[model samples]
Target: MYRILCVASVMLAATTATGGTLDEVKTRGALNCGVNTGLVGFASKDAAGVWQGFDVGLCRAVAAAVLGDPNAVNFIETTAATRYRVLNAGEADLLARNTTWSFTTDVDLKVDFAGINYYDGQGFMVPKALGLSSARELDGRKICVQEDTTSAMNVAEYFKRYEMTYEAIPVAGTAEAQSLYLEGACEVYSSDASQLAAIRATFAAPADHVLLEDIISKEPLGPVVRHGDDDWADLVRWVLNALIAAEELGVNSANVDELKAQGTSTPEVNRLLGLEGLMGEMLGLDADWAVRAIKAGGNYGELFAKNIGETTPIGLSRGLNLQWTEGGLLYSPPFR
Candidate 1:
């Protein structure tokens, strides 16, 4: 019995030694955000090597809210296969890669998706010269797809459901898949619809290729953190919610400061921006947490517009991602 007690005490000491991610992040003074190597609208480095995108904006917002510095983040480039490994290994405090949130990934991978930032779906892109207007037309085409992603499985299922056959040329990353497709090594590139648009924009002749209208699978892409840290997870989730709520409340980066100073009586806005309440304290942060996040980047719609919306190079329509107030599905829970 004494030996068992000694072993139990040692285990308790070890558990206490490995602090939670929130405490570790507070101690380190920065956040490690895992992102894709380069996906134009989602996450990418510019000519100056500064990371920027819709997903990167979320990382910055979280850093701003937590560390009080939007740029206080280290961007770790990771591929689909390496993303989860990096998070599980403690290399990243948050996985902001444009990863799909699925039941299998959430339950089996031991990671929690904080919230859905982007609603996307798997799609097929082919050269316009192929005269294949629909996904059903590709019966036995060679397809370039990312290995170890839902894209591969979704593409296969899509074909099988149509009683078709095809050859899958698996690539390790988006760039590789784009290269193979551009070289005519594969007749089609299968990936998220937004990714297809981004890849097409990079091609020498964007007009020569076309993404099919069919959206095969539901891909709710968002930020993820390692499981077992509920406090940290709540912080991330509410940060995203704050962005969405800000948009719903007509709050933009340009007008945030003005509105905060004016001090509106709206309970939702007050709770969100912490102008009249202590919502941030619930998340173990100051009342100005959401304000800092908004200052880091604009509201959700603004970020989407600046990065990947129809006005951007990727030229994506809001489609199902528009706010419920605007006839879409982007409504957020009330802050109050």
Candidate 2:
């Protein structure tokens, strides 16, 4: 039933989606990408004014796949409150912001999730001084959260399920929520575990905060597009799949070119690199589409490592994000 609804909406999107967002993007010479206002490891601008991160890489990869230029993207900064409005308004061609996949947004809001690029879960962070180690102990405490996000709802649901009462402090975004939490206006800060890590890593006193081990809700964050254009939707879906598939096929940015050179001998690799199958043509792209996207910023694994790996300040281990062969949930459908 869920799949049926998604397909019906996707078909509606194909006939009416964005009124030709792809064409407009082509004429405008860029893919307008909706990104977070400033999340350090997910979607933030660097010192050179270059947008670089895991989410940013996906946007750039999509741009490279479509516009033939990785840099052909205008990153529109948006908040949790405005991210959906920004995409629905056609102000952005794609939203690679760390938006979670939910049933409401998938069907009710007319947005189609491309795929789950990052499997995450909602968790809480509090100062060590609180002496509270478990989320069950958060009763009656003040929690800071961004408005218009799943984190907000998840917090409420978890509390309700626990029959616990707490003060809900709603802020405009993560930055504001963090500020209030740091300033002691709120005792708890709740968001995706990855985001909590990103927020804490940037803090001058990183050791002061502790992320509770209890994950309250699943958060499958990924790219989203307004429903209506099947061709555009198909292109986005395949582009994302291409990235994951590249990783599965061992075709990183460094070796994609070499693998392309050594063609049909490696059937699966050839199909992904767009050398053998009609995959690229099916998506209205050239044979080298996935190559350009992958080369834009290595494969999925490479992006995760550079942006927010254990070596980085965020210091997250690729636990559930590891490829399926390695006992993780990160798997791509066969490119055949």
Candidate 3:
């Protein structure tokens, strides 16, 4: 009865929200997050059927901030073609999949991107035996790519600019493409460089394939929520910013509690940790919202290091994803 009343109160609060998805989420007792269709290091189930990866961290963090429970998330696997449709149809509350933030996807599709979570570029992969040193060398090779994605359009643009012709094989998802690529059915597999690396790591002979050094297109990947949900959007956006900001503030799971307990003198640290500001109240969350989110899976840097960092199987260097102080593009707005 206590649990039922708590959920009812949450639903009552959600009714006043800018979007109905929050109400639905509170009613269901979990956040429905759309994720990639098993893209290994980004979003994939483990041996125990637990969803784990970088993007999964985003979903769990958002759930923690809103519902106060990191595990209160139902991850729904979505395909490239069907991702936005699924979000628009209300099958998912948040699209935490590795979706490129494009003007068309944001404006025309009637969805708003919270922010760019991962700065990436489209690239290609080929067997080392192919001896393809550059993407330009694969003019006649058949390329495997997921359908209805920036990858396919980028492939077309790259080929057209070079005046090259190649066979484009559109697959339904990454698993099939990986299967075909491993079986030598497709000479090239193209996607975001991060994804290509992740997929390559999953290959039986990881050393047999190589990702081309040439990046063909800029892909600012991030989470997406439906348009016009100002309240929901602000909460989601700030939760992401909180993670990024916490990293910049030198706060992590290891030190956050200590920082909160000792009362940091830094104004931003106090504001972020809910000891000295009303930022969380502005977003309909408690003062400890940021703390909950950061503790859910550490700060942004920690999650990156754990999931797809240079030390991981993916071995991706934080080129553009590094903090601004470190000469990268990651910068969060002020907490106040």
Candidate 4:
């Protein structure tokens, strides 16, 4: 907890180096969100060319909070190699991609991770025919990994620490890596477990592949913004917190209006729903900001269940993503 505070303090200080992003975004009348090039269940276009997924849902929520219109956003597709460059260059306003938050990215890249929306870990996937049940079994094998990502670094460190030597087959993007892995360009593929699951679900024979039961590195993925815009950063962070708190407070899309109309004795719920607090005004928004956001696409859990839950093609169970009361890591701070 102390370490987390230290990191947050450093980020707060580091972000003081720039300013005025909120006014700029408001003036533009739309939020430009940077997302993955084509990672299914996170950010991918549907048949209608409309971006819809977990990450995309966050972008929409932010748009709704700021502009009162969830569709008032332009999703800018970014590769692992270009996400930071695009953000720092001001080409994108906020990056809601499944970007991992690390010390290097936070301090060195001069960007801030608003908050963690997904807690993931690195893992490997291989053909079921390999007869390998553990990552330790792959002593010397060719591995496909995406370049310019923590996956590449974590896998390298894992092999080194385990005293194993393997050839690295680097790919520029997820699509290329999937194609190569499917074509037998590499014997194994290493990435976040969620990504491996999402990718494997798209394969012709998903059951033919096996995700090894080994978690290599901690990956806290979330929304990112450039430095020098503390107000915008705070707004982004709190908007996410609003969604999370809404879920925890039992205020979802279906009943937000009803709850708001009836009024609540719960202070937290009232503050969250803009019922009896200046929370929205404090963020330079109208009282119904969170209402708009929640109405945009339900709450965080709803977005998750809709985009990548057990019923979806991604088929991801809310293992580490469940609310705190449900014994997972998701916890929202007090709205007051």
Candidate 5:
């Protein structure tokens, strides 16, 4: 009766199951990473057609860890709607897109989030001339929201709770939302705060637009992989943890070689760098995996500062993304 009653759910899980992603990726000679179609600061191609961004850094790090070559990655473009389809079909070994880990996707859809790489929040961007100080003031206005994302539902719930109404201008992706917003088709564009900052930075006259001081919903964005693959998930999870731990332990790309060559007094750093334990062998990778990963994209803070920090065009600060030592949410587990 159990099998009969839950046959549909079982079948769904079976279809999406990808258990041997590590072996598959190794056999294929490259890591197939799913990324956003075009989110400038998170994932986008540069002028020479090289993928570079915060999320792309994760992909490269994973590639370096698993395949021993950072450049051995094929970035498959996926939209908000088709990201899961591509991942489940086994076309992408991992997804480093800026996806929010929600209950529905986690429990119901059976997606596994490796870890939270970014702590984001829902926000609204409006023209500076609008002079809107809060999202509460946008009653009955047209708001551009990307379809098939948490932003849509969050915006709806927020307006309903505040007893306000607005016409939602649904868009398929960030580019469309940005275009419609710039064309004045909508008074406001609702999205993640990081994305809003990224989009605003790309505008010709960035000062013309301003993000409201409102952060309506918590969005813990992270890397995602399919369920039923604990081995692959652990590898990915530890790679992320290694980066975060590197940041906390002061093992950066600049000093990784020296640390690995001469060794460290910190036992956790030794274990993390594969100098004191069989951590990498346990993951079916060589001992130098974490070192290669950190070298590929530096530590977590380095990736952030390089891709989207205050100096970059995206100009994102390490608000909640700082290390746990500094009272932020980024705390990696002990390498031992």
Candidate 6:
């Protein structure tokens, strides 16, 4: 009897130690998501002080999968210089800001990028009064860019490639860059093209500004989590994969529950929605984890449409962002 009790206690302790982030999250009852201070299509708070955007939707989907409540999220607004610090310091469970997936960030920052949710490129936005038709025309001009980001490197590279000399004024965030550009402190504002469009929509005089046609560098933005936690990483990665899979399987938020009840006819959908497999269990979650996530915000395409699609003020076209079948690079691995 004594030996049995001791073995039972040892097993319990081992289970507790190996439970990973899922157990920690269940005990805390909330997910901490790091977001931008204010970027329209990525992450921003509304008049009611509620956060909503494409990246924010990803956070909500994770929360729904983990905590079963889409609103069980704590948004921590962070700047480019501080986002990685916050994640590495354990201040956030996930970083869903508009961060580019690069070799340095992935390897040196001690963080794991789950997947690329947005395929973007850096561009320049300038006032139409400048009569500039291309980025190459802006020689020796002051460009406002975000500090501690890939934008600065891309800006330097673009200028070097064109044999042009220019002054780059690094701002702390996107809002500040927009402000500096609008106040004529800088000749151009440089960032992602989609972000430029979002900022242009909020301008007091939208028609005054135009985005230059040159795309300098690739910016594949995605969610990130701390390194050395494979279970947590898998949970986040699969949640994103489920969103993409749901879109591929023709599932949306409105019909998610019905599909869940009826069960999926397709094997891929069955494995994704946890109808016939233990995929979620392998990631330390229940079988219906993907189902809960899809119910929270439909699929990736739906989330994009509702937040930053053509109908929205961002008005972005799915040029290189369409799925593999649609001739774009937005394909995901099979759920099985």
What C-alpha RMSD separates each model from the true structure? 2.2, 4.6, 6.2, 5.7, 3.2, 4.7
Deviation of model 1 at 138, angstroms: 0.3
By lDDT, the best candidate is 5
Steric collisions counted per model: 0, 7, 0, 1, 0, 0
Worst 10 residues of 1 by lDDT: 13-22
Clashing pairs in 5: none
After superposition, the stretches of candidate 4 with alpha carbons farther than 4 Å from their true spots are: 1-19
In order, what lDDT does every prediction score?
0.90, 0.89, 0.90, 0.91, 0.93, 0.88
Candidate 2 residue lDDT tens string, 1-336: 999999998888666654487777778999999999889999887899888888999999999998899999999999888888999998988899888898988988899898888999999999999998999999999999888778889999999999999999989888888889889999999999999999999899999889999999989988999877667777887888888888887889998888888775768888888778688777767889999999999898999999999999999899899999999999888878
Better of 4 and 5 by TM-score: 5
Which regions of candidate 2 fall more than 4 Å away from where they truly are? 1-19
Residue 121 in candidate 5 has what lDDT?
95
Clashing residue pairs found in predicted model 4:
18-228
Q: Mark the regions of model 5 whose C-alpha exceeds 4 Å error after superposition.
A: 1-19
Q: TM-score for every candidate vs. truth?
A: 0.95, 0.93, 0.93, 0.94, 0.95, 0.93
Which 10 consecutive positions of candidate 5 have the poorest summed lDDT?
A: 11-20
lDDT of each residue in 223-317, candidate 3, tens digit only: 89987577788888988999999999999999998998998879999999999978888887788989899999989999999999999999999
Tens digit of lDDT per residue, candidate 1, span 1-336? 999999999888666534378788889999999998999888898899899899999999999999899999999999888999999999999999779999899999999999899899999999999998899999989999988888889988888898999999999988888888989999999999988998788788999999999999999998999877778888999999999999999888998888888878787887787887778888888989999999998899999999998988899999889999989888788887
Candidate 3, overall lDDT? Answer: 0.90
Clashing pairs in 1: none
